[model samples]
Target chain A: MPTIRVSANGEAALETRDVRVRYGNNEAIKGITMEIPRKRVVALIGPSGCGKSTLLRCFNRMNDLVPSAAVTGEVLFHGENLYADHVDPVEVRRRIGMVFQKPNPFPKSIYDNVAFGPRLYGRPPDLDDIVERSLRQAALWDEVKDRMNDNALGLSGGQQQRLCIARALAVTPEILLMDEPASALDPIASAKIEELIQQLVEHYTIVIVTHNMQQAARVSHYTAYLYIGELIEYDDTNTIFTAPHEKHTEDYVTGRFG
Target chain B: MSPADSARASRHFDQELQELRELLLRMASRAEEQVRNALAAVKQRDAQAAQRSIDRDGEIDALELEIEERTINLLARRQPMAGDLRTLVMTLKISTDIERVGDHAVNIAQCAKRLAEALPVPDVGDLDRMAEVSTGMLRDAIAAFIDRDAELARDVCQRDDQVDRYNDSVFRGMLSEMTRYPGAIVAALQMMLVARNLERIADLATNLGEDVIYIVEARTVKHHAGEVVSDVETEGEFDQ
Candidate 1:
């Protein structure tokens, strides 16, 4: 309702313009363009194989791990072309860490789990400070502060996911991409991850791919609906739920056929 | 088991909500029309429609109770959130408004019965016009509600001034007529009360329309007609 357009002036935390990703002969993402506003959660929602996850991996060049995969078009981070030849994909991965759909905690001590990132990137003089701060930022410090030396695998799946989040945060990433990070956890754990995601938004720009529309509505500031590898609509979360402009977006959100 | 079945069920829910809103609008429209009919009956000493207006009040009362029950069931069972919550609450409030309008119609009918045997008061042309305008305002106001037309609601709100002006004219004309013909004072006074009741009905219609605008647009329009009128006059100055 404010006269000022919320989107007109801020630096986009991340953006993709006409991005297309392909696997062998199959095109996974088709001409999708969007801007993720700085320090806000942009929830990507769609049915399976809708290219939300494919597009999310594009943010940090995670799709490059798929040897048969190739990406085309721009993936910009803070005005710099992330896909540029001169920009190190390694450095891009560092500044834009990700949490996978499953909790993939390292088989190491809890302190080492979080310390792994800072150590891999060459520890700052404040390595201990980094580990403590990252765990605290991920909202897992109080639960694990006294047991920092315990194996991460000993923790519950939700705790391990939070551990993974703390590991990602250890590198001081400017952007966080989560691919259904709570899908493997119980609802209580999912709620905890959701609560953490909301808290993390204060310091990190986030893009999340989720199948749960209610989760997207509850946690996101903006929502983007994708269908069959194409971006259908992107808008504020409330508008997307209550008064979406596109028929497809409405059908999808209101539980009509995808 | 089938997509069409699911779609049909969803449509059914939407239609149910739509039907509830339409019923409320129908009740409001009928009650408003009765106000006009009661006015005509009073002026012409036509006992038939005056009696009809009194009879119609029972149906409105039934509708008011039915709408309240439906809204309560929706709130209790659907557990609606956000915009849906606003809608159910608005339905409940508008039902109360229309029900009160029905009571006013009945009151007007009672007044008509008393004045029918008394000496005829001179036809104050403005009273009839005021009744028409008030009824039109009530109809359009409820139409604005059913359609969620914020602009139409604002227009309904602005027209309240004309009804008020006519009401004043009715009062002044009756006073002068009473002084000129002291024998007709009692009948004139009853007619003036009917005009005042019609004006109050118009005011209630404005409130109903304003409530709809609030529920639909999430902007409070009550006590803000000047702001709307000014914004319309200076189109470039205010944010839409």
Candidate 2:
């Protein structure tokens, strides 16, 4: 295994050293080393089952919930090894939050949903202020500020996703991991999410996994191309979209491959 | 094939790209021929041949419009990236350049027709050489574009200085002829106009060359010629 090149500048908020993930007999992620820059959006893109999602999961110890799954190698957060003994996985997840492929908002009111994480974890003082600030950070405050008591499920698909983002923000994470955040929404809604991602990146480091290369090009500052569980290429978004070094990456981005 | 490659390759978009390339090549070939014939018309002082160049300008204009429409259609619909995106954008820009090249040919033809109608001046041999070099530059630039040859495009850019030198020589020669022979003044000025048009043609060809370099190498060598340094090119770490 070799050190994967991360060409972009700035200190890496999250770093992976030869990280590999395996589920039972199947090796899903090969040894991959990456330096994800702080306060920047890095998008992981590849074809289905290429380990983009698996690698993204490793950033926050999301793979720990799976049985028979083993992740070797170190995932470091700002120079601290996350896999060290006594480092709680729950705390790791709380610090590094995730938004899934679909908008999985709770059945409760929008305000309650944003407050849920805080109440369960630290029960931060001034719960109302926290909820308001989270909603504002997620760009959902103006739309649902009056309807804070409304059920989150009653909101539009795009709004529900934003509410989910607000919920994720309620915990006040340092880094945000989004897996196909806008894949389930309409083009207009997807554009909104993309805009939100751009703004939120100023406050938190973001790592997104996306199948849409154009969206990756649009929203991310950096892009990583993965193929068959192996890290193929990682570079700035402009380079990956315009002139990728790897033949596999070129083929994938140009629609020469699936 | 890899499993993903075997899945679905979007063959329709690939075919569209192929068709667009061919159409742009055809347009370039037509423009190139018009340039050659128009320069020949100037050397021969043949109004009939000059008229042919004038007649074809509308066709080139229509072709330009068609290429623009198709390019916009592909960009809006396919949402291309990487090499495909560069190709389509350069096609749109190169077509505009070629169409303007066509217009320059027409301007040369107009001068040729006026020179044919006026009293004759001594032929300036350098204008013929300048015509040959500029037309050849146009041909090679289009060739580099269609073939995706960045080096060939750079060669075209390097030749622009030569055309500029010939233009300077042609201007001095025509000015001397105008000063010497009072009766040949009108024809000398027409010849000068023809030389000016040829020089502009060379500049457009240089534009085509710079665009081809972008299409082929993903490099912007527009104002600065030779080696273009970008973030991707300078970052040695990502070379692996």
CA lDDT of each candidate? 0.82, 0.87
Error of 2 at A43 (Å): 0.8
DockQ of each candidate, alpha-carbon based: 0.18, 0.50
Poorly placed runs, candidate 2 (over 4 Å): A1-10, A147-150, B1-9, B226-240
lDDT of 2 by residue, A117-157 (tens): 99998778899999999999999999999989999999999
Best by lDDT: 2
**In candidate 2 chain B, what residue range of length 10 has the lowest lDDT sum?**
B230-239
The 10 consecutive residues of candidate 1 chain A with the worst lDDT sum are: A1-10
| CA lDDT, candidate 2, residue A182 | 96
Query: Which CAPRI category fits model 1?
Result: incorrect
TM-score of each: 0.78, 0.92
Q: TM-score of the candidate numbered 2?
A: 0.92
